[model samples]
Each structure stands twice: as C-alpha cells, then as structure tokens.
Target chain A: MKIHQLSVFLENKPGCLSAPCRALAEAGINIHTLSLADTKQFGILRLIVRDWQQAKTVLESHGNVVNVAEVLAIEVEDKPGGMASVLEGIERAGLNIEYMYAFTIRRGDRAILVFRFEDAEKAAQALSKAGINVIDSVALYDLVEKG
Target chain B: MKTEHCDVPFNNVSAPDFLAVAKLRELQLQRLQCIVDRAYNHVMHYRDAMEQLEVRPEDIRSLDDVRRLPFTDKTALRDNYPFGLFASPMNEVVRVHASSGTTGKPIVVAYTQADVDVWSSVMMRSFAACGVHAGDIVQNAYGYGLFTGGLGAHYGAEALGATVIPISGGNTERQIMVLRDFGVTVICCTPSYFLHIAEKAAEMGMPLQDLPLRAGVFGAEPWTENMRRRIQELTGVRAFDIYGLSEIVGPGVGIECDQQNGLHIFEDHFLMEIVNPDTGDPLPDGEEGELVLTTLSKMAMPMLRYRTHDITAIKTDPCPCGRTVRRIDRISRRSDDMLIIRGVNVFPSQIETALLAVEGTLPHYQIIVDRQQGLDGIEVQVEVTAELFSDTVKELEALKSRISHAIDSTIGLRVAVSLVQPRTITRSEGKAKRVIDRRTN
Candidate 1:
C-alpha cells in the first residue's frame, strides 16, 4: 500500500540537479518518478526509484543529505481525467496530498501516480475504498523494472 | 586648538586624563602595588598563584617587576566559581554580575560600593569620550541580567546626569517607538544589534537618521570598521566601540574618543598590557597580541594580570584630543575559540550542550559562522538519527526549530538549525574542528 521515495537535499547550483541523477544512473538505480520542490537557496529532489536504498547510498556517498519516505503509488487510467479523479477521491477523504508525480507503465495503458500525503496509510485506505489500484512497494518496483 | 566639526575636544580635562607620561607611569606603579597587596592579602586564589611563583607582594618594587605576578585566565574564574576572587568580603559587597557561562558555569564577580562608584565613573568617562553630554537622553539596549552590558551603561548614563531609558534588548517595534517618542540621543548596544534596529526602523517606514539619536556606544562583541561605516551611514550617528569584560569591569573598560581612531583605556583605573598569547611575553606598544588587564581601582574583585584573550595592540602616540592615556586598536580577533555571534559570546561546546539536551539529535554538529549583509549569521548543522530523518517533513522542520530554540535559549543568539542525516558530519582525527568562521574570508 506504500512505496519508498528517495529525497536528496541540493544547493541551488548549476549542476545540482544533474549531479544526483548521474549518481543514480551510475549506480544502476532507475528513477521511476521525480518531483522537485525548491526555494531560493536550496532544492529538495524527490525521486521514486526502483532501488531506493541503493539510490540513497549513492547520493549520500556524494555528500548529499538523503531521506527515504513512505508514499503511496497508485496506478490510474492513462486518460485525461485520470489524475483529476484520484485527486477528487483524496480531497473527499479529507487526506491532504502534499505532492504527486506520474510516470507511464511500459505494458499497460495506465500511469503510475506517486503521492506524498500527510497520512500515507489513511490515503492508501481512502484510495482503495474509492476502487483505485494502490500499488505496494514490491509491485511498484516490478513495474519500474519492467519499464 | 579644537578640531573643526568635533563635538568636544576632551571629555574630562582632569589631571590624570592629561597626565604626562612620566607622571602617569608613577601613578600606575603606585596603583599596581596597591592592587597586588590587596589581592595577595585577601583572595586565596591570588595568594596560591603568587605562592606558586615564590613572589611576594612587595616584590613588585618597580613597574617591570609587575610581570613577576602570575597570569589569571578564564579557568581561574571557573575554578573559583561564584565569588572566589573577590578581594572584599561578601557582607560589604554591593553588587554582583556574571558572564553567560554558555559552555559551563557562569563566572561571577562581586563589587563593593566603592567598586560600583569606580565602574560608574569609568562608564561616564566612556560616554563623555564619545561626546555624550549631560541632559541627553540615553537608551540602554544591552540585555540586563547576569550579563553586564545593561546596568553598566544604565548607571553610567544616570551618573552623567543624562536621562536614561532602560529599554533592554528585543521588542524591536517598541524600541523604535522609544527612539521617536522619548527622543533618545545616545544608544548603548552591540554594533550588530544597532544595525538590526536601524533595519527594523527602515522596515517600519521610519528613517533612523531622522531620529534624535546622535551617538551609539556599541560593545560586548567584536565588529569590523566596515560595519561601523555601514552603521554610521544608515543611522547618521557616530558609532563608538566600548570594550570591557565582566572579569575586569563591565562596559567602561575602554572607549573610542571623538577622534574615532582607537579606544582610550582609562589608565587611572585599569592597567593594560599586550603579551604574546602563546608565550606570555609582554609585547611593546603597536604590537598585536592578547590583552592583559589588572584592576587598579576595583575594591571587591581586583583582577591581577588577567589574560583577556582579546587580540589587539596599543597605540602609545599622544592623541590630538589631549588625553595622555594610550588607546588600543579595535579588537579584530580573539586568541581563543570564542565566537561573537550577534554580539553574544558563543562556544561550540555550548551548542553541543544544547543539542545533546534535546532528544532525537546526535552528538555530531558543526558551527558555521558567516557574515551575511554586513552582519554575523550563525548556522548549526546537527546530525540526527535516521529514525528522525524518516519522520515527515513537517515533523522534521518542527524538530529543527526546537533545536534552534533550545540553542537560542542557551546562548541568547538566534541561529539557523539544520538537521542532517546520521553520519553526515565529518569525523575528526585529532582535535575536532567544530567552528567554520567564513566571516574572516
């Protein structure tokens, strides 16, 4: 019902964003989805990777502050209103969504939407009740590997 | 001849203020002998130190023999704790003051009524040196507590027959209001805090230059001359540096005259010396080294050759302002590991103490000191457990703020707290380098 997301702290320099990506790529860790939250001085690079532990180790070895957070990864329809429907269900459940990013699954005509919520467990239950497919860590890793 | 555009040529034209070099040395010798005798007969710590040197009080026959005395440092005060260094008994003691003791126990000093009078007179001289006169309104913004800045300036203003507003630090809006309503003419605070006040005034759409403030007596921390220029440019006030420590006396140890060149040490009250910090050898005038002071007039706690750790040189040339007392250059750096952040003396161990007291924080931390926009900024980066790292962003932010607040309470200086992942801080082999002072660069 939850997925592991890797967050790395980066100073707002020219090559900060690429540095982490290169580190992950060199470590053979595939990034499933990413969303960047930034301010004037620094930025937080949030990545949902197939091998999050390896991604964290690689980033930390590069002197970056890395944290692993549990988030919900849900598979939604690839149509235009797919993300909107999932957000509507989350809004109705009173579970706030901090941020979300999406990536397409290789085989199915669906997209994987990674969500950070105030309460991950509550968000997962609310999405499940709304008949949405909540993918666990193992299933999400498998899909990313397949891609 | 008086210098043009100067407020006053000299604050006091008394005999000692304009004493000839030979006569001043004679007076210093007499006073030095008196304090040595007082300390030897009264304070046991001084007696033990002197005994260890096998030197008698009467051995200080000449000014050069004064070096035969033992040197006192901060550790002496710590070992004695509250009032072990007082030459006068507690029953006769009139007041007590202390350092923040952020790293450990606070160093306490007591003063008798006569010593308090001496402190006030020196403070008055300090204000007058900056051209602050009687009938002026003084706003004393130094924090009043165990810290000595507030009451030290407060009594000096009162003794100078100036109206004093005892508005301590903080409450920025109220400070501005008083600057306007009370028509403050002189402000006493740290140079950094004064700039902060000026910034706040600008934020409130008020021009600090338009206020009646004319002079600012800033001390209790080291500030650069460029900062002084910025302060003068912003507030249209003459910023003068006042130097002192609780171990010596409070805020009136030395002050810059209208010359604005260097601070004039009140030679009549304090005997000043500059010695090599590493070797303890006395350096000649114009040579920068650690400052050593001896109380010539203090009755209760007469510090004898106390190593101040503040690094500066003395200027022996006579000033055009007609004062014979030598002036010390602005303090640039300390020989020790003390950091003056936002005008508060901070040590890395103090931050470590605060961080260790708070839960969820590891022992590893680094102190980063930088000068941002002509003011000192401190950031404490602490490594926390991975469990705390796995917490939600909101919780992590709360924890960071909590650590910051805890450190603020401990050191009385605001600092940015960064909670990093465990094992992120670099480990040291020999002596751990806890401070990164980027301000010097």
Candidate 2:
C-alpha cells in the first residue's frame, strides 16, 4: 500500500512556511504530518494532508511549485524498538529509506510512520511481506480525518 | 603559410598611410579646421559647446589647438539620442548602427553614402593588413544586427575583393562545418568568440590548427597579446587587432599591420588625440591617456573631440610595415566603469536592475566576472532575506532560476545565480563596490 505526500518547494525565507500552511488551512484542508528538509538557500516541505488535491490547489493558487510523491505510511507500536524493527526489515529487504517522519494518532495507541523510499512500490511489498501494517492513501486520509 | 612570410605592407595603403611626420601634421591641421567649422555650422550641440568655450572655428589653427575644443563623452551622445548629433540631413544618412545599450538607450550612429564608402575602405585596409587577399574566403563571425562589428567587417572583406561568407556570430558546430567545408581563410569576430570557436572545433575532434584559416581580424572588445599568441598557436591564424568605435566609425578606426606591433590609427579619416581624462589636457606621444577622436571624413555625424575612454599611448616611431600613420598600443583596459562580458557591454547598474525585479532577494549583490575556457563567465551572488534564508531547497532553487532568467532576459547574457546567506555580503561605507573582475590577463 502506498500513501500520497505533498512536496512543496520553498525559498528559505521567513513566512514562506506560514504562507502555504495558512493557505491550506483557509482551504479547510487538514495537514496530518509535515517535515521540513532545508539547505542554506532553500528547503523542501513534505506534507501528508487529508485532501491532497485541495491542498495542492490552494498552495498552487498561492504561486507555489507543488508536486505529489508516493510514500509508504505504516502503523507501528508506540514502543522504543518499534521503528528499529521496521527499519531492520526494510534493510533486510534491500530497500533504502530516503527520509521518514512520524505522528501519533489520538484514537490509537500505535504511531503512524511516513517513509519516503527510493522505490516505494518495492518497499511496500517488502514491508507487507514482513508483516508490517502498511496504511494505504484511503486509510491514511481516514485516520487524518478522524483526528 | 607562416605569418613571418605573410607579413608585408597591404596593397591598399593610401598616400596618408605613408605621410611623413610634417605632412601628417599639416593634413591633420587642415582637416581639423574643416571639421571644426562644419560641426560649428551644422550641429547645435557642438556649436553651443564651442561657443561656451569662446572658441570659434577660426580659432583652431594648429593640431595643438584641438585642446581648446570641448570634450564630448557618452553623456553627450545620450543627450543627443537618436539623430540629434548628425551633421547631415536625413536624406544623406544611408545607414544607421547602434551599440547594445543594456542600461539605457543605445548609442545610435548614422553613415552617409560617403561615410559608408570610407568605412568599407578602412575595413578593407584592416583586412589587408592582416594578410587577407582578394581570393581569401572570409568567414565573418561578428554579430550583425544593431552592432557595427558584423556588417562593418563584411563590407570591408568584400571591398578587399575577398569572398565573404557573411556568417554571423554563434552556432559553433555550424561555424566549424563552414570553416572546414568552405575552406575559410580569414575569420573575423571578437578575439574571445574566436577562441570559443576553436574550443568547439577541438571538442568536435577537429582542432583549429589543422584548419585552412590563415588570419583573423579581431576587435569589438579589448584583448591581450597573450590571447593573440594563444589564438595563433591554437588556430594557426595570425591574429590582428582592429580598433574602432561606433561613435567615430565602427570597426575601421585603426588596424594592426602584419608587424603585429601596434594598431595604426587612420590619421586621414579620424584625428586621434591623447588627453588627460580628468583635466582634458592633451598628452604627448608615448604618454598613455584617454583617446579623443574627431571624425575628419564622416559626413553623416561628425564627432569633434569625442572622448573614446580607451587608455593607450601613440607611437610615432616608424613601423616595420612602412605605414607612417602612428600606431596606438593594443588596448587592454578601459577608463570607464563598463565591463565587456562576452563582447556585450555590461554595466553594474544593469545587473542591479535585474536583481531588484526578482522577489526574496536583497539589494546587496556582487557581480563576479571570470574567464573560463577562454570565454567570459558572470556569476551574480545575491543575498537572501532572513525570511527566505530558511526556505525549502526547491523554493530557493526556483528563486535562483527566476533571478537568472530575469538577468538573462534583461541583458541578453547568461549568468549563474547564487543565493548566499543573509547579511553575508560585506557592506561598503564609501562607494558600493559592485563588481569583482578577475578576467584580466
């Protein structure tokens, strides 16, 4: 199972982050999780929102260059070794994780870990075979909406 | 053939080219008086400037009296704009050419039929000086449109009875193919552009030295002796420097004889003077100063004591080629703030305009000019605002691209845009230092 993530290009400037966040909020699109990757000049804001299309539309209307990327979102136990166990399975399956971020669902005891892998489809199959509970876009949107 | 054997007096050398010192001075004095009288009678700008100096046309008796004339700079040209400076009426003006003005309005120059003939003859003399003959196939690579370089060289090559390919600048692969296929003998363009062609030829597995090209009449921008040697060594072409300005006459004011010593100023057509740039006082021979030119033969627009701002000394010593017209050393530097990047004149102010148009960029920026692979490279390092300093990599990259595109569209030159950290650029208290040029030889 794969999850759709919104990757936005942002100049490393003040109010650049808030502009998109405000736009998405005004559009009534809820962001489930966001992680920022930055260099001195610019940064990439990766986000998982409840409505990807609406979030992209609102951001694009604000003159932002937005793109969609497929990632693996899996549910893991909110325990110390939970992330380590999933990463070890990914490593064993020869899949490399580009970056990852996590957020806990208020309704469940488990944590939602979003991972961007070099090959998302291959990682999804390997994680599924490894007995990891991979959440698809529908389930991920539902979880985000429930919160 | 080797350059040493080809080094000889051009067949088109006129009587003025062989005038003795006394005769040359006498001719200059007579021509100076005629032009001064013409400018005073025709052009109001020159008349007012002369009247302000209280110097009448009759006052210019000797060549030394040229100092009494008011100095005309680029400001005068800008003030005159389109055709205000022309001495002749519109019907007499046969052609018009202009400098690429990235900062403001382009400097416009007009040529009458007589003026066109004079330009062609002078170009022919320049080509002949470089050992180009009637049978030689001249592949002109200088830009043709508004700039005087392309058509100027083309007319001259044709006047010399040489077969001109008339191929304008750029298109490196095609330039090489034409060079090989046509067996082009003489190449004409800026020294830097020629070097680029040589590099491209080498990349295409056809080094220029093996080509049939024999001579190159290179000008439009200042170049070095080392660059000449490198061009000759790589392309096996004897490179000669041809000097001219659109203000006086484009691409035919002076040319280097086969001696490759100094560019011989065409004393009969244009009166050349060396003057102190600051004081406007004349400097003697062998003393370096700003070059002032008065168009003696130009009919459309006769520029009187027009300051060239090119720093070089005149050589009175006789050249081995026997051309008695005095030679000015090859120009390597300019007294003005203009920077010639890839044959296009760029001012620091032009770069500022380009930067201010883009968002998220601070006013603080530095233009760095360097020579890489014998071609000019410009890098605009702009400071990002504190807010934008933390933007995503993709956003910053987009900003950089936008800036680069703006500058390219504005100036017609490609530049690498670098987004530096906020407050990283040094603040200057006095004059804001905008340019860092390391392309000097």
Candidate 3:
C-alpha cells in the first residue's frame, strides 16, 4: 500500500510556513504530519494530509509548487530494536530508503513510521513478503480520526 | 549563371557558401551607402571632413572603399558637443545617452525609434546566443542612468519576452535576496561587479552556486580567462563576455555564443574592422590591432569608421553556432590611458578637470588603480597648495571631500582622494605622468 504526500517549494523566510498552514486550515484539510527540509536560500515542506488531491489544489491555488510522491506507512513494534529489525530486512532486500519520519500518535503497542523509498512498488512487495503490516490511505485516515 | 530573370536580384546565386557571403556583402554595401549619404547630407562635420578629403558618398562603391572615409574618434564627438553629430532632427530623436569622454564634456549619443528597435533586436539575439530564452527571469545589475549598460540590458531582456528585474547595481544583499526570491536564471553585469556580489553573498552565508542562476552576461570591462574559470568554479554560471561601447550603440554589439571561443559580431547592423593603431592601416584577419566599428542602420547618429581603441583580433574560423557573422577575440588592452574603474570609463583628463575644479587642489595629481579582493579600487593622489597643506586638519578634510565630490559628480564613480604637498609629484619635462595602474588582469 502507498500513501500520497505533498511537497511544497517555499522561500526560507518568516511567515512562509504559516501561509500554507493557514490555507489548509481555511479549506478544512487536515494534515497528518509534515517535515521541513531546508537550505540557506529556500526550504521544502513535505506534508502528509487527508484528501491530498483537494489539499494540493488549495496549496497550488495559493501560488506554491507542489509535487505528489507515494510513501509507505508501516507499523513497527514499540520496542527498542524495532527500527533495527526493519532496517536489517530492508538491507537484505536491497531496498534504498530516501527518508523516513515518525507519527506522534500510535496504536496499542505499535508505532507508525512513514518511509520514502527509491522504488515504492518494489519496496511494497518486499515489505509485504517480510510480513510487515502496511497501512493503506483509508486505514491511515481512520487511525488518525480515532486518535 | 542564371538562365531566367527573377524578381529578387540575387535569387539565382547557386552555391550556398558564395550566396551567403555575397548576400552579406550586398547588404553591407547597401547599408553603408545609406549611412554615408545620411551622414554626409545632414551632419556638417562629416560633410567638411569628406569634402576636405575629396571623397563623396558615391566613392564608397565597394566595401574596401571604406578606407577612403575619414575616421571618427572620441574627440570628434566632443567637438560636436550635445547634438551636432546627430543626423536626425531633435524632435525625431527618441533617446539621448552620454558617456565619459577624455575631458569634462561627455560624449552624447542619440537614437531614433528605429535605432532603438535595432539595438533591442541585436541584444535579444545576444541573449539567445548565450542560451537565454523567453520565460527566464533576467536580473539586470548594470547601472541605470546616462550610462547605457542598465537600460540596454533591461529593454533587451523585456523585448526577448523574459521577466526583467530592473535592479540597477549596488545593494549586494538586496541583489542576492531578489535573485533567490524571484528565481532569476540570468544576470547581466560587469565581471568585477559580479565577483563583488559573489563575495558578499558568501559573507552572508548564502553561496551563489546554491542559487538557481544559470548564466551571466559580463561586460563593460576587460576580464581574463582565469577570472572566468574562477567565477564559473565559484558560482556555477556560464560566464559570457559581451563587448560594446556607448559611442557605437551599447552592450549589444557582440557576445560569446555557446561555443565560448570568441564573440560573434552582429554584422547586419554593425560592421567591424581591425586597424593598426599608429598608422591607421587596415589589418588582415587574425591580426591584433585597434577595433573600429561602423553602425549600418543607426538613423539618429551614424558613426562611420569610429575608432574604438580597444585592441582585439578577428576570428577567421567558422563558429559552431551556424551564424554567418564573424567573431572577435576578447578585448584585453586599450591604446590609451582610459581606465575602467568599476565599469565607468575614467580618463586622466577627467580626473584633472575634477581636481582643478576644487579650489585648494593643484593640477599635479596621479591616479592609482588596483584590484583588491576582486573589486576595482581607485585612489587619486593630488598635490595641495602650500597654504592648504599648512591649514588645519578640518579644512584639509573639507578640501578632500570637495575634490572627491567633484570627481564623483563628473565620472559617476567614488574614489579615494589623498592630498599631498606641492612639487612632491615628479614633474616630467615632456608630458606629465598621470595614471599608475597596478591591476594585473
């Protein structure tokens, strides 16, 4: 399963982050999680939101260059060696992870980690073979609503 | 050989090579006759010079006959003053631009609507040669005013349909800010000034190589290959050398194409020549000498055989860009003592005029020009009178400021003015030594 994420281009200046945040708020679009990548001149704001199509439209209408990328949301044990175990499997499978981030909320004894891989399709197959519980967009949204 | 008659005169020429060269010569001849006729009829200076030499417009039948025409120099323009050299009436002249001459009086140039259009067309071609296209954001950093660099690049970028930011020089921080915010893909300015900006950008923790700027059009001063390599390594921009002078038109005369070997001259509008500086004899192709230019289509003021005094050679080899126009080597030397300080032409006589205008300063002065930390710095050392030298420090400071202000107002460049005792500056018997340039490149 894959999740859609919106990456926006913005200048690294004051109020640049709030502009899109305010736009999403006015449009009633909920952002599940967001991470900011920055350089000296500008920054890229990556957002995982519900109703990504509507959110992208809202952000673009406010003059932002937005790109949609597919990322995977997988559940991991909330133990010390959970991430290491997933990394060992990924290394054996020869799947390259570009970046990853964690969600604030979690299920009973598990945590959700969003990962961006070089090839999402192949990574999805490898994770499925490894018996990892991957959450689809609908299930992810349902989990967010419950929390 | 043509078997049948055609409406177009040269349509029957068969060989492509012959046709191309012949057609270019035909256009040059036609335009040359027109310009000479216009200059000879309207301008009194050209008329008197041509009459004294016993040469008429009809004498210029072949391109080689250009040698028969009188050579026009900067002094001729100064002699004509504000509007004497202009062939068109003042009402029809759309614009006037003045640049620093050898003396206090600046050389004035005029342009009609058609002349301005020609300038824009050539500049658009220049940008295209440098791989700049429409929709590219061009940041023009040349000084805007009577100087032609700023407005020339501005109008050309706008005419090319690119978005132009008219940020005319200075304010290095603001330049970097606008460059990053507007996603400027191209920048037009002098090479030294661009280096200064790059230095400031680095100091501000914003390196230029990280920005989206892709190309730079640098001109108005001579730069070397080493500096080009340094700029490219530092900022990752494809630096292109553009050559021009206000006496001709502006910075649209010629530019280095993607080949980056030599600058291709727009032969359709301006004719090029290289002549021996001392003898004024026309040199063959590939010989280094003085640069002479003749405007083919300028209506307001048509310059016939104007000596540019810039030393460069003509490239006889064909360019990969496929344009039939010829190319010229980059200019690295001049035949005179005119110093380009921060892209403004500075002559010793202009400095002398500025220093003499101040009350307590003597005519004995020396200009020292150097390139320190990638920027051109000029310091004027002048001798003060015995009374002014013995005066209080406050009055001496005031005199220094007045002399500096006079120079700034005359040449549009800020320079350091230092006052010295009289007779300290060595006096030469024949000619006084005025300029001492320490720049290696």
* All candidates: TM-score: 0.82, 0.76, 0.70
Task: Estimate how well candidate 3 is docked, as a DockQ score.
Answer: 0.00
- Cα lDDT of model 3 by residue, B1-441, tens digit: 111211222211111212277798899889999999999999999999999999999999998888999999999999999899999999999999989999888899999999999888878878877877777899999999999999999988898888999999889889999988888889999999899888889999988888888889999999999999989998888899998899999998999977899998888788889999999999999999999999999999999999999999999988876668889999989998788888899888887888777764456788889998688988887765433432123344676788899998888889988764345466689455788888776
How much does each candidate deviate from the true structure in C-alpha RMSD? 4.7, 10.1, 25.9
Q: What is the interface RMSD of candidate 3, in Å?
A: 29.0
> What alpha-carbon RMSD in Å does predicted model 1 have with respect to the real structure?
4.7
Candidate 2 structure quality by residue, lDDT tens digits, B378-431: 999876553443223545677778889988877778999876543446768844
Sorted on DockQ, best first, the list reads: 1, 2, 3
Docking quality class, candidate 3: incorrect
What value of lDDT does candidate 2 attain over all alpha carbons? 0.82
- In model 3, which regions exceed 4 Å deviation? A1-147, B1-19, B359-361, B421-432
Error of 1 at B33 (Å): 3.4
Q: Is candidate 2 or candidate 3 better by TM-score?
A: 2
What residue pairs are clashing in model 3? Answer: none
lDDT, model 3, position B159: 87
CAPRI tier of model 2: incorrect
